[model samples]
Target: MTGTPLLKVRDLSVGLETGGGMRPIISDIGFDLAPREILGIIGASGAGKTVLSRALVNWIDPPLKVTSGSVVYKSQNILDLPAQKLRMLRREIAYVGANPAGALDPTLPVGQQIVEKLRAVAPEIAHEEARKRVIDLLGAVRIPSPQMRYHEYPSQFSGGMMQRALIVDALVSNPAFLVADNVTQPLDVTVAAQVLRLMRELTTRFDTAIVFISSSLPLVSDAADQILVLAEGRVVERQATKALVDTPEHPYTRELISQIPKIWTSEAVAIDLPAETRKPIISIRDATRSYRVRKRGTFASYSTVRAVRNVTFDVFPGENFGIVGESGCGKSTLMRLLSRLERPDSGQVLCDGQDITRLSGKGLLKFRRDFQLVLQDPFNSLPPRTAIGAIIEEPLKTHGIARGAELRDRVLSVMREVGLPGTLYDELPLGLSAGQRQRVNVARAMVLEPKVLIMDETLSSLDQTEQFKLLKLFEQLQAQHGLTYVYISHDLAMVRRVCNRVAVMYLGEVVEIADNSRLFFDPGHPYTKALLSAVPTLEERRYKPEECLLEGEPPSPIDLPPGCSFASRCPNAFGRCHKQSPVLTARGNKDLAACFLVENTLSHAAA
Candidate 1:
């Protein structure tokens, strides 16, 4: 559209070679990307977005082949290049994928892995220079203490940190063009916001071009200069970001836009319960959990990670209570504490007036029947070799709840309840869609007839279409069974749509807790405000991202500071914030905030 394009595509198509014949996965796609511009490709899962990304870099493997057309980068058609030329071309073209956990080798240090990649792509570069570049890029991505983090393994990094490290890995070579495929999908809102801002800054600083791919339309609209919508292996719409969102010509584009959850509007769904009249089904009083891990590159030296510290909350019966935070804020550890998977080092976890921390033997089994934990990953959570029916029935058999035909009937009953057809009962989970597998997961939990369910980022991995359906199912199940849910997630939009009450955590502490309407509209703690500002939405933001979004990762849990953990990043932090920690105190009718600013205001008001 402007001066000589950096990359040009015309009539590109990709096909999967099947036994029946070749079937098209991407058909007749075309676009032009200029230097320093960002193009976003958005669609639901299985819309051939990944296939198109792979084809752009010529990374297509066996059973997948380019059926037609050309992808010309700098006047050379990449689709027609040989292996040797392609290998050399990679130095100027980089691709960063969605799943950072599996990208790097767990056995090697993260920085070492990145440096090795750099040396492989550009063998002429010296090892020292490559290492220095990787470290600098890591710092550029705002990973705290890059010099120390460089020696840490992949397992030692949290989800957000690992994702940022992967970006450094991609940019260390100074590639002119990048293909980032759903890089922020696994991150919490704040971390995702940080990553998007970093990408925008990189395009200006490095003069690089990018093709950002994701399922969420709002996320893409935030970062992309232009958007290309794909549906059923074809480009459905391509226009400037604001123009397309404000007035779309295609029906598919409109449908995708409709699926995004509303955050700051009257249409957003919320649960309003009379929580005061009911007792807490599960209550945590001053619960604290910690662990000891070996120091980086040290065999004997160890340090303590205070994963959850002085956390306390209560979930009223039949209420959807939400726990929201970024990665490494101890959401998972607190979930484990609530489910009794790991007992806290101190404090009490009570269930229906009974201390659940001390449950053992049959008592523990009974507790299991009363409470169920649904995990995040849909692929690895269930056994690959086991049949779906047998997987669901294992819990029944283990608890001795039923036998023979009775167990079979109960399993089918729940399978139907969760909208999973009975035909797949005998089939292994080999090729089931992510949503269907998650349905199996829900069926497994529902079959136990638990009164309370702890969902830990349960819907994070699925596309918005699937998440919406599952949320409706959860609501129907709750109404029929009178159930209570404790949702642990980094997805603030989803939490806003479903939860009656929401809690914000930072550096292993409860920074704020309030009703859903209050938390989103009038957050008290700076960290809570930061989380709200970072949520990706099409509506005008209640909290401006530039004013409240945090700048860097949370402080290390291994050696937390004596004062407020959030002080280092707080924009309004004063002298006292760096000297003394604050406790959760009353803010309004039922809201709580842990901030000296709020404490001072309340004191002044009383006087």
Candidate 2:
């Protein structure tokens, strides 16, 4: 690391245009990034970390302007730079935002897009050379089969994969500095670890100074050399990663630290329903979901992608059941089946012991009233033009449950239940913050008074404080309404906190199933253990490099390996593991794991 700084910000403040003139968003934010240094900027969702990042790059869009700030890059004030010079500066300083989908061009192939970006920045580079660099960068980001994935569009990639692709895009130009805005938020722990490792490698090899922005303190603390804590758009605390984590001086910083979910410790108490209510509220019996995708070159010939393969599990009444796995592991696909948004190709989806997989017409419509789905992106899930009141009331109206004053009363009641202010009832969803929008989503879901609520990565996008608040709200709602939740997420830390029973899935198969404490603390499956170990914690800044690091990306669900789906990556895989698939069997007193090693251990103990 050099004494000379790569980027410097002084007295930075940003403002948004409002009816009452300019309103301050971020005020008096100051920081410096030295060569090869990682500065982690962490705060709640609206804390203006993103605004500061955008200001540093001079990329703040209209209505949100840099009111007072001087961002200096290599002795040059970026805000004062001319358009052409600014463009050149941007080539040396890249920014990757939280939303990868927005960064990418949906119409173009991802690889082609990267190549285009390379050529745009360096016009002297040949197409062939740029293409090679694109593939190499993709590989560097741990994207499997870069050659094939290069030709695929952004739509074809999962959220985590898309985020990695954006990272590659940022690094493609070999920028001297990078602003990684919540890059690891969507990724599973394993992938996030790999990405962070790659970023560290870049800093060491190329001296790329980075500003790693995130909502989670522990996550950034693991990767960053220095930590800057922001609250209400101001820098509340700034310290070395260790110093900040060891003893956060600010109350907000301390509260943020306290909220981070720890896998090593168990604070979760299983919510036990009465014996009569403990029966399966929702059951998936050998459910399979497949999609036909056209071959790379030929439109006529298509191959089947088995997203969910023979997945079976039961969600008991009044209990939070979690399904966790890496991206493309069928967690979301299975949730869709439970929500009746998609029908399974085979097997049955039983609700209260009655098959609802093939329900249609009135049957399907009526069945929907019994359950609701809360999606990952609440803003997208809700209609932009519709008022929050109408959005929440639509479900109740569709079910023919109420109307007129009664409908408005029910909507207001549900809104209150989700902690949404009554004043915001007539306001459009666009006017609400991310957390508020999510609350609106929850209110809409609850308006029908559904017995089952399927939350598919709902809280994954929110900041830690918002997530904690929503989690608490979920518990209260469950207690008050007797709601049974089917929570599907890649966030194991969250799963550990909110779930009563948890199931670990890999490539569409359930590899492990146990109570939250057992699954996280004493995972029987190697894959489960690896996932848990990958999670970053304040106690351990860096996980042991050699321990529980997965070998490669998960094999394609379209053409899975002959034996176990995770066998190739499993450290304990043997001859039988390669030849045969292991079924979920008892591994401990109350846990089930689909691993030959676990089975062998159990057999030896019995003998």
Candidate 3:
């Protein structure tokens, strides 16, 4: 490469020792990241995106080892360097990993983890100096109240916060380049957007080149300057982001882009309860799920953690209703409540106009068919030991239409339907790619012919191509079988693509619900606006980020605010927002929001 690009690789090959044989992971891959270029590496899970990143970082763990490759970091051959020397170089070239949880020790306080990293990179710096640098690093990643939060364990922090902490840890070295591998996957729309914006700002300020690798095409398209598409552990296509996105030369690349969730009619709409049907499929009235904390040896010994505080919502037939919020906002808890996985402390869960709140034994088993949950992480969610074929057939065996040979044929058919080849039936979950495993997850959930599929961030781990493919499949299934969905995800972009309506959740309750188109273009709640504005759009516009009407973190869900949950983050929140909890009030046809701004905005927009 001309004048030695910051990180240069030539003819890289990585292989894993399996059955006493070296099986190739990545073959003959080569790329360069110059000082100014942020190269986006786009690929599906099996395409070896993470493997390639590991190869570049020279951090390939165990069984999967790099056999032959020359990874030159700014003219120095990192392969030739000693472990100590490589460690020194790593200080100059950081690696931000995929599993944010594994990067840090869960037991250690965040402050200590970051300080330790700083000390490792900067050995000469004193402990106190390193600690300040740690807090400064926290600020760099936009973590709030670093002083108070420095001692908190990883479990105490949100998924987005944990990721931000890891980013801060990576940036402690002030590296010349950073390898961000699926960094945006764990975050919500607002957090993901802000993190990317901060990363962009940091890259400029620090003049750091980033090798941004992700399964997301839309994110890669929006964030990266250049694009590299990988398939089957090889480079399939490489070009500038705009050129590649507009005119993708590869058929695979073309298929990948078409799958990203976008609003069908070009506007984000809120979840609108259907008017034709008076009675909803599932209804919750005054739902409240509270947990009491009791410690050993105390008179009082406990405090109550109210997860769902008088929450109420309805799900209609064939509706793709969504719940959007920060982590621990009780969205998931509420989901479990609605699905009857757990009983609400006090509320009525009416199913088909019957109060099935205390659904026990046989009744709950029947309800399971009505609602099926597609999980987030396919690796952990899928049975690793079982064959892919058997995994898909389990639901059928328990509660299915066919029997014996008929069931086997149906399983194979379902496998093909979800894009998993029939031949992959014998394959274990470990053998398949991340995307392939997720396909199996989809297949297993769909195999039983459930009426309502509860998708819990099912598309989070997939590349944009795979995501679009699955989403399109959902559309087909919905059209043909009239499958309803309770789609739960943090990716607002994807939410825009599939859902007819959405509900924004913050701290265990629905803050807003409406038609998707109106919600996107004209967000009502400050949180909704912040969330919508945070999504990194491919379409550009002249806008100032500081003009966003939101800031600050929501109070701990364990001890929530007395008034509106978003008051701390809302710029428009006055005394009313702080003093009285705003309920979801009707603002328009099939639209509602728990905010004061919508009243003013709706009136003004009408005027």
Candidate 4:
């Protein structure tokens, strides 16, 4: 490493103004990035991960002005630099993040986009080489069929593909440093793992200093040499990744670590918790869902894809059962089916073996009362026009249960349960912080006091402190009211702490079901193992790719493949796995793992 910094951010303070004045989001925060080094920045959402990243690039918008700080990059003080100098520095020494919407002109083809970047940075380059360099950069980011993809517009590509193209565009200038902000957010686990691997390799291959910004710790843990943990715009912890993960000193950091999504592939609970005291409320029996998709064209043919195939599970009364999977793995769709938010195209969703899948009207209403859902984004889930109190009372009004004075008391009580006081009852969700808005969403869902709360990434956006409070509150609520939870999230570690059993979903199917202990300690499915491998550990300073990084994008669900849903990507894939679908078979202690490998290994153990 050189003596002087590549990018030095010193004593930076950012403020959040409300009502009439400014409050600090980041306070006297400082960090550095050296040449050929990678720095991972982790913080709970709204803890200033986004704020600090923007500040580093001088992208922080007005009303959230920088109070005082100097961002030194490329041998000059960036904050002190004149606007033109700063702009030049951005092109010469550093590259701000590539916003997919902002990076390329939407109407133009992707090939032209790459050329524009090259021409912008080095106008002297000839047309032939610039175009060739476009293909080379495209290949560098692992975009398949570069020739064909190059001609496609940004709109024609998937979110993942667009992100990759943007990454290519970002690096076309051969930047000395890279600041990647949530570049992997839109991708599924397999693709995300691939993207992370590519970024690490590119860093090593190009020797570019990088400042990686993300809300996910494990995602960045392996890739970062040193981690800068920020909270409310202040540096909470800065240390080597391994030391931080092994013995996280900060209370906030520890909570953040514990909140990662815990995946369940088989039915094995590590420890006994005070479980709920009721019969199995929801049951699954060979349930599956398939979809038929048709593309936009004059002669587009309809195609069918089988998503959830022969899946079976149970949701016990007052017990939390978590469902985890990559983006394309059909978790959200399955949850929606279970809650009757979306009707299944095939199989049965059994409520006490009554096949609630076929119910409607009164029967459906009764079933709906048993379970209520809260989506990932509360701002989207909650109504903008409605006051918090009214939103809470809406569910009760629909059920025709509570009225007038009685309903108001219930709403207030639920709000208190979720840490929202009476003062917030009439507040618009717009002004409230992300955490507070989520609180209102939870309060609204729990007001009628449903048996099961289906939270689809409910706490994804909150900072550590807020997430901890909410998790603790959830535990308290479950214990007090005997509520069953169907929590869905991407944070595996957090899932382990809260849920007793987990069902692992992949490509629209439950590949494995296990107790939290067994799944984390001895995951059976290849995909499960790969998922665990991708999780960042503070203990390991250097990035290591998954033992078998899943290969290929998930098959198009519209037309679907036969046999195992993971056949296309599974590293241990055999002829049988490719030819025949595996069924969820009985393992000891009510645990189930659906791979032929697990079946073979456990059977061999028994023999």
Candidate 5:
């Protein structure tokens, strides 16, 4: 705190060229970053966090300009630097964005792309040396088997691995300043915690100052030394992480902190299901789904990817059921089986006591009417060229349910229910906000009058404020229509707030299932404990991260080892765990878990 600042910004303001005139995006922003220090910028969506981050690195594009103030890095004002000098300065200032999949070239090997970037930044470095640095950095970031993964393409890497690879790319040049913009937003809790920890370590190791930008306050508090809260394009609060979290000065900052979900608290209550609807609206019994993929290098040799393995669950009517797991744990695949998008290899998917897998033609159409799926990624889900009204009305037209003026009325009615204005009905989705786009998605799904709605990471893309609003809307819609929700997500806090019952999946298998209160308070499976420990929160952790946090990734689904799928990563795994697979059995009142530790504990208690 006493040394020279690595980067300094004063009275900074960014403006966008609008039809009427120039409009201010971020005004009078000021911050200073010491060497090896992390300054976290926290705000909701449209709060100019991204714009401010881009401006800090002089990456602002046309129509958006830094109207005033200075961004000085190492005594040099970067905002006033010329094109040639600014390009050279940027090499020392790195940036890693939120979207990892779109950051790298798919055609090239993952390591090779970083090597190319290093060479471009410093032509003096040889190709082989650059490649070595990349491989070394990859390992430093905790990516497994860096040497073997060096030749693999981006598509071959999982989401968490690819994100770490991108971090390696940013640090390859040994940048003095790094801007990480929402880097951990898309990752699951375990992977996100890993990334946050890694970034803090990298700053000390590389002697780099980082500007960490995110929409999550608890997440920022976990990684940052100091926190800056933004609201409507202005700095509302700034203080040390503990000081701000404990005694907030600004009302906006207090509001942001209040929105954070409280786990292990009495705030979450178990929902009571109606006894009249005795049967489960949807049930999956031993459902297994697999895919055959050609090996990376082999021409004819292929591997079977057991995406969803013997997954069993029941979703009763009028209750919000949740499916949660890390990426590639087969949550989406299981959702597809429930929605009839894919048939199981050898099991049954029952809808209201009837096997819907064999249904086709009119029967399948009728089944579709009862089940609707809402996908993640609000940007790409809706058609860009189509009008909003037409997009929402497609399901109705496809089913031949309505037409003409009647259809228009129905579409507008659903739009109003989802809080979308009818004036934007004829507008394309190009300029809409992320929340607005998701509302359009909701309206489209609701127009069909489905009895069950399957949301696959639907709220993952939105900021906390938008997510909260949409969740309130969902509660109203469910209450009005008696709809059952199947929410599949990696966000544990959201799951804790909404779901009546939750199913925890691991490596294509259901590892644990319990009521909302039971799952959070007293988990049976070790894997479930690990997930809870990894969740980021301001409250005191119920599970110690150092003890329960897993070290390595799960074994490959294609070549899954015999015995318990979680044996390798589980901290409580034992000899029997490696020799025999555990079956889901009762642990408590309606609680089920597939772990030998639980079985042993229950057996010992009975003895």
Candidate 6:
């Protein structure tokens, strides 16, 4: 709501040139970014939100071309600018992407990379000054011990930290306009909240306009002042954030809102286990895992990172057990232990009361056939060159279970179960959409008829509608196959919808374990409470600074304190919490929490 618009887009249309001829990807998308204002773009995957963002900055790569558009900034049309001038114009317009790992340079130290980017934009700035600015930018992103972390490479940083670093890199030049394209999609809820909060603050402080593109309607609704709904590469509706959420007019917008999984309470749904399958199918008894990481300063010295520390839990047959936590919280490591991909450093992982942690040769192969893993990134997880049929058939062929016509029939059958069309079996994964690729992943895992399925953030990358469809498919598959699921995700709401029981992990240990309703409604651990509070709702887009806000980043797993892993960030942390690590103890009816406060409350109730 200012004098001059920061950026303006008019009659923008993008098209892809293929063997079949030119096909329109985005059509006549027009919008304005006013100074210090955020314009949120909400759309499902393949709706052309990403293409529209690329077109704004004139970075539409290969095979795709912007046929018609005018990006007006600083009283000039950027599309009409010369190559040299266009490059200069790009310095004042920045873009941050969703995948931090792909965006960063692994060879260079993260801080050095930031300095190099800054110098590229402003060559006049000295190296010493650029380094200082990089440190300041890192601090602004809430990265703890910026100076020390500056020397570390991208591999050392967690997913959340890397995303923040990418943000720091994007803002180094203090651009007049910023394009954040689904930047928080891959991040954990708490980290996403932190990054979004930082972005809002930095944009406001610097008086920068931003175009925030996201598939999650609630996320964009909470982060931006105005929301633009896009469907089939066209703008369907545009309105203020609150108005759009409260009374969405467009059918597409309304549908997007309806698909979001809400936090469930006990009364909302029955979360009971089947009577015959009450016995634990998979059990973890004091399981621990550690990795030796080489020290930065000393070549010979190394530190042991306790990735999974005394993690103990049970997965009942035919029940969905959810593991929720931030990045580097040992969720994936624990999955590895359960799947027998990696043996635990200590203790045992029992399958039907038999330890399978050290199973080898024929036994290991049989165990692998009984358990399968679904990874997070569907596009990357699937091979680009291979056809969908081959990818799904590989699992069956590897185990020597099927071949020839039988193999093709099995793949197609599973594909139908996951809602993938049989016609696309011969098509490569590169041509399919994100949702379809994930369906293929599900089909591939289910082809082997596994008894246990471990989904590690499998649906996090998809749009709300796609996620909803996949969640339904998961339930159907579970019922049909009698599969036990260990769902690992940072999405608390999705976990609530899909899981019967939930375990909240912090750093590298389980902080709380309870039924879905109890975990969401009456979280016993402070860390769990903070995580739930950080989730964005339809009514509220941003986390309140005062309500259960974690004060600082988690401590490094390599040099963890002797006490509780979450003690540093726990709101109710006490002297005992900092001195002694609490074990999971009964807090409520069938609920367990590793917290001194919960123990005290239980004792008081008994007294």
TM-score per candidate, chains pooled: 0.97, 0.97, 0.86, 0.82, 0.96, 0.96
lDDT of 1: 0.90
User: Candidate 4 lDDT, tens digit per residue, 1-607?
Assistant: 4556788888898897788788988899877788778899988666777777777777777788888978888767766677886667655454435235556788988988778767877889988888888887666555655765677788766445787787777777777778888776545455566667766776777777888888778778857888888776678898888888788899988878775543332333333444555557788777778766553343668656566766778877756788887765667778878888777766778775578878889988887877788876655677888888888888899999899899888888888888898987887777787778887877877887788888888875554556777888888887787888887866665677788788998867788888777777777787777776665443331213545556555666654667887888787889998788887766777788888987898789899
What digit string (tens of lDDT, one per residue) describes model 3 on residues 400-441? 467889988999988888778999888888877667788888
Positional deviation of residue 224's Cα in model 6 after best superposition, in angstroms: 0.5
* Per-residue lDDT of 28 in model 5: 98
lDDT of each: 0.90, 0.87, 0.77, 0.74, 0.89, 0.85
- TM-score for candidate 4, please give it: 0.82
> lDDT of candidate 4?
0.74
For model 6, which pairs clash?
222-541
Clashes of 2: 0
Tens digits of per-residue lDDT for model 1 on 1-607? Answer: 3577799989999999999999999999999999889999998888999999989998888799999989999889998899999889888999988777588899999999999999999999999999898888787776767888998999889777898899888888878999999888888888788778878887898888999999888899999999999998999999999999999989999988787888888544555566477888888999999999887668999999899999998889888999998888899899999999899999999998779999899999999999999998899899999999999999999999999999999999999999999998899999898899999999999999999999999999888888989999999999899889999999999999989899999878999999888888888899998888988998899899889988865677887877899998999899998899999989987899999999989989999
Worst 10 residues of 5 by lDDT: 264-273
Residues 386-455, candidate 5, lDDT per residue (tens digit)?
A: 9999999999999999999999999999999999999988999999999999999999999999999999
Model 2 CA deviation exceeding 4 Å by range: 540-545
Tens-place lDDT digits, model 6, residues 1-607: 5677888899999999999988999999998889989999999888999999888887887799888979999888887888899878666889988777678788889999999989988999999999999998787666756887898999888776898899888888888889999988888888788877877886778888899999988678768999999999999999989899999999988889888877642233344467744778889999999999777789899989889989888888888999999877889889888888889999999987779977888888888888889988887899889989999999898999999999999999988889988998999888788889898888889999998989989988888888988888887887788898989998877887888889988878998999887777778888887887778676342235477867677787778887887888877778988889999999755799998988899888989
- For candidate 2, what is the lDDT? 0.87
Across 1-607, the per-residue lDDT of candidate 2 in tens digits comes to: 4598888899999999988999999999888899999999999988988888888888888899889979998999999888899987767899998787677889999999999988999999999999999998787777867888999999999888899999999998888999999999888888888889888998998999999999988789879999999989999999998888888899998889888876665478568676753679899999999999998999699988888888888888888999998887888888888888888999999998778976899988878888888899866788999898998888887888999999999999988889998998899888778899999999988988889999999998998889989999999999899999988888877887789899898888888999887776678898887887777776552235477778677787777898888888978889999889999998656579988888788888999
What TM-score does prediction 3 earn?
0.86
Model 3 stretches with alpha carbons more than 4 Å out = 1-4, 15-28, 61-69, 128-149, 155-158, 231-261, 264-275, 292-306, 396-413, 416-426, 541-546, 559-562, 601-607
